[model samples]
Target chain A: MTSAPVYLVDDDEAVRSAFSLLLGTYGISIETFGDPAAFLARAPKLKPGVLVLDLRMPAITGLQLHERLAAIGCDWPTIICTGHGDVHACRRAFKAGVVDFLTKPIDEQVLVEALQQACAALDMRAERAEAAHLVAQLTEREREVLDMVGRGWSTREIAESLHLSPRTVDTHRANIAQKLGTTSVAEFARLALIGKAP
Target chain B: MIAAPSFEPASPRMPRRLAFLRSSAALAGGWLLLVAAFGLYAAETHRRALEQEVSESGRALQRAISQRVAQHDAHLTSLSALGLAQAQPSADFDLVARSILRFYPRIVAIDLVRLGPGGGVVSSARAAGGTTADPAAVSAAVKNLAAGRAVYGADARPGHYRLMKRMNDTMAVSLDIDGRGLVEEDELPGWARLDLSSAEGPLLEIGARQAVPPFAARTVEFAAPIASETQPLRLSLHRTVTLSQLVPPLPLALFAALSLAALVLVRSLLAHRREAALARAAAEAASRREALRQHETKLAHALRVNSMGEMASGIAHELTQPLTALLSQSQAGRRIAATGGLAGSPVDEVLAANVLQAKRAADILVRLRAYVGKSAGEAGMHDLRTSVSDIAALSRIDLGRRGIALDLDLPEAPVAARVDPVEIEQVIHNLIRNAADAVEETGRGDGRVVVTLTRAAEGAVITVGDNGAGIPPDILPRLFEPFFSGKPEGMGLGLSLCESIVERFDGGISAENGPSGGALFTVRLPAAGAIDEAKEAVQ
Candidate 1:
C-alpha cells in the first residue's frame, strides 16, 4: 500500500524537530513548515498527505490555516498537533475535516499510532481505486451476472431475468469472481457492499 | 494673665526676661537714692549739733574762770586799801602776797613788786618756787604799765602758756600760773579747749589757766601796780587762768537728740524703699514665670499631633494590587493541574514557572510592606503588552466615572523598570477621573485620558494626560504635599503619595500643563529592571 506524505506545520523548533523525528522513526515521510504563511505558499503542489499542524502560531493560526486549506479545496487528510487545546479549536479542527487532534509536547507512541491510522485510512482509499480498476477490466455481461449474484439471485434466475441461458450466466459469474479476486460469489457480494468493483 | 506680645517669635519668654531686668534695675536705683538722701541728712545734722554744743561750753567756761580770778583780785585790793586812805601806808606787801598765795594752790607764783619812781620797780616779792623777774623785765613791765597797757605773752622762759597784764593799780605785782601740773591730757575735749604747757606754740598759746581735765592744765601771767606811795606809775597785781577741759555735759544731750532723729529718718526711708523695690522685682519675676509657662506650653503643643493622617481612598485601592497579585500568584498556580497544560510540558519547567510567579509576588509584597508598595503591578520591565493591559484593567472604573475615553499607547519592547507600578496606575486612574470630573464640572464629557508609556535611552516614561482644567498657577507648587486637596471632598494626598512612592523607587513623577492643554503627570522610571538589583539587598 502506498503511504501519504504528512505535511507537518509547527512554530516551536524543538517540538517540530521532535515530532518529525518520531514520524521518521515510524518510516513516515513528513514535510514541516514554521508558519501558516510558509505552509500556504507550498500548499498548491502538496499531494495527498496527512496534515500535522500546530494549533497555535503567531500569524494566521492553525485553525485559520485549516480553514484556508478547506477553502482552497485541498482534500488532504489533516491531523492537528497543538501546544494548548480548547474545545473551540478542537471542534473547529474536526469541522475542518481533521482526522485527529493531538496535543504536544507529543507522546511518541500516541503520535505514531495516530499517524499510522491516518496512513491506513489513506491506503484504504487507494485500495478502493485499484479494485475499481480491476472491476473495469471485466466484460459488461460478467458485471451484470455479478450484480445479480450479489443480490442473492440463483444462476438460473439471472438467466431468466436477462433472457440468457443458465450455463452462460454461471460462466459470467465465475469470470467476475476471478477478476475481483473473491473465492466465491458470497465474498464477491461482500466486496460489492464496500462499493468494490467485481 | 498678662497679654503676650502680638507677633510671637520662637521664644515668647524674651519679653518677660527683659521686663524683669528693667523693673529690677529701677527698684535698685530707687532704693539707693533714698538711702543716699537720708544718710546725708543724718551726717549733716550730727556734725552741726556737735559743733554748737562744743562752742557754747567753751565760751561759758571761759567767763566763769574770769569771774573767779576777779574775786581773788578784789580780796587782795581790799587788804591793801585798808592801810592806804588818810593814814600812813602801813600794809605789809609780803603778808598780802603770802596770804593770797595760801588761798590759791593753782597759783605757782605771786610777785608783789612796787612800781619804781617814774614807772620803775620800787620793791619785788616772790613766792617759794618763783624768782623775781630780772630788773629789765620789771622795767619793761613798768613802762607798759605807765603806758596803761597789758603785756600778754607766751612763756618766754620754759614752762607755761603765760599772759602778763601790767595794770595801773597801787602797786606793780606779777602773777604767774605754772603748767607743771598740766600735761598729758586724757580727753579730746580737753585738747579742744585747753593748752597747758611749759611751752608756747600754735597749740600752747590757745588757753591760759582757767579750767582743765585732771591730767593737764595751761597758764596765763599778769602784772599790775599796787597802791604803795613808792609805786606811783607802775601797774602790778593780776591773775591768769587755763581753760583746758572735758566736754560739758549739758549740750551733749541736745546733740544726741539731733543725731537720733536723723538716723531714724535714714533707716526708715531706706527700709521703705528697699521693701518697695523688692516687691516690684518679685512681681516682675512672677509675671516672667507665667510668661515662660505660656511659651513652653506653645512649644510643647507644636510637637504633638491630635489626629491620624488621612490619604485618598483611590490610592489605597491602587495600593492593594501587587499585594493582591502576590497573593493571587500562588493561588493561581494551584489551579494549574486542573487545566492539564502539564501533560505535554516538563513538570520541572511548570514548577519553575510557578516559583518564578511566586517570587514576583513575594518581591512586591516585601517592597510594599516597607512603607507602602503603593504601586500597581503594571510597571517595571514589563512585557509591554502586559503593562498596557494592566493599566487598562485598573483604570476601568475611573474611565466609566468620567465618561471619558482612555487610549493606552504602548510600545512593544519589554519596558522593564524600577518603579512602583501600582502607583503609576493610580496616577493614571486619578488623571482619568480628574479629566472626567473636569468635564462634568463644566457640563462637557468629551474628555479623554491618554496613557502613554514611551521608551527612550534614558528610561521608560509613563504619562497620564487629561483634557481637563489645567492646574492653577497657585495650586501647582504644593500639589504633591499631603492633605493639600483641590476638590471639596478630596483628601489631596493621592498625587503627593504617588510622587513619594515613585521617587522612593528612583523614579521621577511630575505634573504639568500638557501641550494638549490639560494637566499632565509624567513618570519616568529607570528601565532595564535597574532598581531590582536594589531589591536584592532589601527585605
Candidate 2:
C-alpha cells in the first residue's frame, strides 16, 4: 500500500507551517499552501491525499473551498482544522465530506488519529473501486461461483446451489481468479465482500 | 474691568408660580371688595329700616299728645262757659283748673280773668300766681272772644305752655301745661326727641344735645297741631334712631370675619394646588432623569461587555497564529534533535524563533487583559499620552479588520491628567470605535482615523478625527444624548457614557465638524498637576 501526503491549506503562514511540522514528526508527509487560491492552483496535480483546511481565510473560507471542490468533483478525503467552529460551520464541514473537524490548539493524538481514519477511508474507497472493476469482468455463473466460494462452501455445495456440475464450478472459479488477478482465497473473499458497489 | 454679562436661565416652574401668586392676589382683592360691598349694603338697609320704625313711633306719639291736649281743652271750654254764662267765682275757676289739670297731665295750671271795658285782664285763678295779662294778651283774648275761639301758647316756662279761651268780652279762661310730660310720653330708648312749638321756637328738646351725622343716626320728625283751632300750636316730635337699635352688630362682624377666612382658605387651597403640581412635576422630572441614568449605565455596560466578547474572539485569532508558530517550531526542532540530524545553527534558530513567537503570544494576552480585564479603577494621576497609545494599540486589530488606518498625533512629552486610567482609556477607545464606525459607514477606501492629544489652558484635550462623511445636521444636537444612534447595530450609549465619564473627571466632551471633512470628537480632562495646585490653593 502507498501512503499519500496530507495537504494543509490555511491563510496564516504560521498555522500552515506549524501543522506541517507537527504532522511531519509523526512520519506523515505534508504539503503546505498559504491560501485556498494557491492550493486550488495546484489542486490538479495533487494525488489522493487528505486535505487539512483552516475554516477562515482572507480570500475565501475553507467551507467555500470545499463547496468549490465538490462542484469540481474533487472528492479527496478532508479533515477540517480551525480555531473556531459554530454549529453551522460544523454542519457545513460534514456536508462537504470532511472526516473530522478539529479545533486548535489541536491535540496531537486526536489529529493523528483523524488523519489515519481519513487515509484509511480513502484506501477503502480505492479498494472498493478495484473490487468493483474486478467483479464487472466476471460472467454471471462466475459471479455465483465466486460468491459461494467466498462463503466458504465446498465445490459440490456451490455446484448444487447453482444447479451446475462440480466440474463447471471449478472452471468458473479458475476463470474468476484469472480475471481478478488474485488466486488467493482471502483476496477473493475480500473482493466478494465489497464488490457490490457499496 | 468690563465684564461680559452672564445670563442665567429662569427655572421652569417660575411662570406657574408667578401666575399662581397673581391669581391669588387678585382673588384676595376681589374677596375683600365683595365683603366691603356687602357690609355697606347691610348697614344701609339696617339704618333705613330703623328710620322707618322710628318715624312710625314718632307719629303715634304725636297722636297721643293731641288726644291729651284735646281733653284739657274740653275742661277749659267748660270753665269758660261757666264764666261767660254766669260770672264764676274764683273758687269755681280754681275748682275747674284743678279738675282740668287732673284730667290732662300735660296741663299744670288754669286761669280765668276779666277784661274790663278795655280788655284788661282782671284775672283770679289761684291769684294767677303773679302771671299778669299783657295788653297784647288782652287784645288777643278780646279778638278770640269776638271770634268765639280758644287759644294755646308755650311761652310760659322752660317746659310749660298755656291754653286760653275767651269766656266773654269782659273775661277769658287760661291754662298752663307742662311740656316735660310730652317728652316722657314720646321718648324711646336709644332715641331723641323734640316737642311742640308755640310762641317759643321749640317747646322742648330731649336726649343728647350733640347733633348726629345724617347717615350715622336715623332721625324722624312728626308735627301735629294741638288743642284749639285758632291757635296754631304744633307738637313736633324728633326721634333719632341709633344703628345699635336697628340691627345687631355681632352677626355682621361674624359674617365679615367668615368671608375673610374663606378668602384665605380659597387662596391657600389654590396655592397648595400650585405647589403640589410643582412638586409633582419636579419629582417626575427627577424620576425620569434617574431612569435615563440607569438605562444609560446598563446600555454602556452591555456595549462594553459585548465589544469585549468580540475582542476576545479577535484575540484568539490573533494569538492563535503565534501559538501555532511557536508549537510548530519547537516540535520541528525537537524532532530534529531526536533524530541526531540537527545542525547546531538551524536547531538553535528554530528554538529562538519559537521563543520569540511564544513571547508574541504572551504580549497579545497582556494587551487583551489591559483591554477587557476588570481593574480597581482607583482615580489618580494618569499619563494621557500613554492612555491614548494604549487605546490605539487595543483598537489596531479592529481597525485592521475594517481596513482602516489609525494615525496618532500625540505629543512627545507626557500629557498628565487626573482620572481613572482604565476609564479614560475606555473613553478614548469608545471615541476611536465611533470614529472607525463613522469611517466605515462612509464606505470609503482607505478610511483614516487620527487621534491627537494636546495641552490646553483648562486641561489636556484628546481629539479623535475621522475622514468620513460628516455627521448629519439633524442628529448633531442629539449625538451625545442617550439612545440616539446613527447605526442600526449601535447601542447609542457610547458617546453619552463617554461624555459622562469625562464629566466625572471634571472634564467635558464635544463633537463638531472638522475644518476639512468628517467628524471630530474632543475630550478635555483637567491636568493632574493643575488640579493639585487648585486643591492646594483651596486648602
When summed lDDT is taken over every stretch of 10 residues in candidate 2 chain B, the lowest stretch is B1-10
Global Cα lDDT for candidate 1 = 0.54
- DockQ, candidate 2, comes to 0.18
Give me the TM-scores for chain A across all models, comma-separated.
Answer: 0.77, 0.93
How much of the true A–B contact set does each candidate keep?
0.00, 0.38
For residue A54, model 2's alpha carbon misses the true position, in angstroms, by: 6.0
In model 1, the runs with Cα more than 4 Å from the true position are A129-144, A151-154, A161-163, A170-187, A196-198, B1-539
| Candidate 2 local lDDT, residue B425 | 79
TM-score of each: 0.28, 0.42
Candidate 2 local lDDT, A48-163, one digit each (tens): 78888887665466777877876776678888776543433565567556788976555456778888898998889888988998898888878878888888899999888889
lDDT of 2 by residue, B441-464 (tens): 889998999999998878899999
Candidate with maximal lDDT: 2
In angstroms, the error of model 2 at B366 is 12
